[model samples]
Target: MFALYITHPQVRIDPDVAVPKWGLSDIGSARARLAAESAWAGQLRRIISSNEVKAIETANILASASGVPVEIVEGMHENDRSATGFLPPPEFEMAADWFFAHPHDSFRGWERAIDAQTRIVSKVEAILAEHDPQAPIAFIGHGGVGTLLKCHIAGRPIARQGDQPAGGGNLFCFDLANRAISCDWTPMESWKGESRKG
Candidate 1:
């Protein structure tokens, strides 16, 4: 009854390409492979992912290693920033801070942080409600919404403090039965802990 919410790893950042279409970099793939080799990977019975390419790629690597079929869940995407299009990293950081700091307000017409959190929580709950609670599941997604989900599960207020560290390829675990977080965000490949193995 354990569930891991995992964010995809580093991606090929190209200014010309659509952000969602960008796949993992070589280092990202290698990191995912290493994480898949962990003993924890063997315990996963279900794998779900966002429709984004990077998340799907990460899910595929994990599914291949675990022999679990990857299922795409439609509503599990990154927060909708399409309204403002892509911003450079520095600008992105500023926008993200605004997103979390002002949960009720939309920054530059993007999805309101509160709204995104609600959607993610609703979708995740619906998915869990339909699945076998006795089975352990993994959900692969992007950092933005992943942090939002983490905050909900952790009973934390919307804040950047709840977000993952700078890089990607991170995860946190919670109990499927009660939705209580057992572990906070940590590196997917290197963290060794009770929750990590579940």
Candidate 2:
């Protein structure tokens, strides 16, 4: 069996709304719906999601298709950026670069990249500890922490180079038994569950 880490797609950007509360944009929803119809989604026996609105929405779509309940797990959220609230794209990009470049340092009071990575990895490990290895599972979350988790699974140091493509809705799979990555980032809507066989 394989476990997939899937990032929520584009989100509705609302400067006044909390980042965790922001829901999916129309495009994001459409992409998620498309992913939900894929063979991969239907194969999921367990769907774990962050408490963030966008992640929950994406998880719900996949769960609906898979007939699996969405399990909202805390600490699976993106690296904490609440310190600076929301920054415009350009500024956010620069901050993100700094965040990744200095994994031990906090960017504008945001959670240190190293810390976030540890949290996500721990959360995932705890969940998998109790998961049925024979069943396929999907974890719905954001790019930052998802990249962190991916880096850990691949045995690479935390780096933004492993980050997903620009608009999200991407997924990467890992073997359930050994936790070895089976695939790299691929758009959720385009993945056909063809990489790793049971």
Candidate 3:
């Protein structure tokens, strides 16, 4: 019995904005559609996503293609970085680095990496427990939290942190039972190739 953890790439919202809810960009939606058609077309028994808008948007596309309803899981959301949400990218990176250096105190306005990991892992474990052991599930989530969740599952201490995925770009799959990883990182150029205009 294994569950598949998949992330929505190119869904990064503007860190300097008060983005309470923003849908995925054009590339993000395309990646999700391709992901459904590629790795998880008929294999997934269920589709789940973080409660955030970008995640939901991505999940909806996957679910539509796969003929599964998207279930929202609030527990699997990205770390709460609402406190310093308006910082520019460079400042945000510095602050995030400081947060990794001080996890215990990282949740003043944002959730600590350790806390976020705990919540996400526990919820995922619970989902596994609730579902049929042999049924496979797919999850859509944000990049920063999704990558950290992988780090936690892999038992690697995150030396540097915040949304930086290793080699995989962002779209990935973690086999819960066998601990295998398969990443379908759509290259930035490839994403640009698929970009659509309104």
lDDT scores for all predictions?
0.88, 0.94, 0.64
lDDT of 3 by residue, 1-198 (tens): 344556555645675545547667777676666655654445567888999877788777767756878899878887788876666667766876876776677745788877877888788778876776566677777666675667766677754643445322254444555555544333322332111111
Candidate 2 residues 54-146, lDDT tens each?
A: 999999988988898999999999999999999999999899999999999998899999999999999999999999999999999999999
The positional error of residue 81 in candidate 3, measured at the CA in angstroms, is 1.0
Candidate 1 shows a clash count of 0
Best by the lDDT measure: 2
Supply candidate 1's per-residue lDDT for 190: 79
Taking all chains together, each candidate's TM-score versus the true structure is 0.95, 0.98, 0.78
Alpha carbon deviation, residue 198, candidate 2 (Å): 2.8
Q: Find the candidate with the highest TM-score and give its number.
A: 2
Q: Compared with the true structure, what per-residue lDDT tens digits does model 1 show for residues 11-63?
A: 99987877888899999999899889887777789999999999999999988
Error of 2 at 77 (Å): 0.6
Could you tell me the lDDT of residue 26 within candidate 2? 98
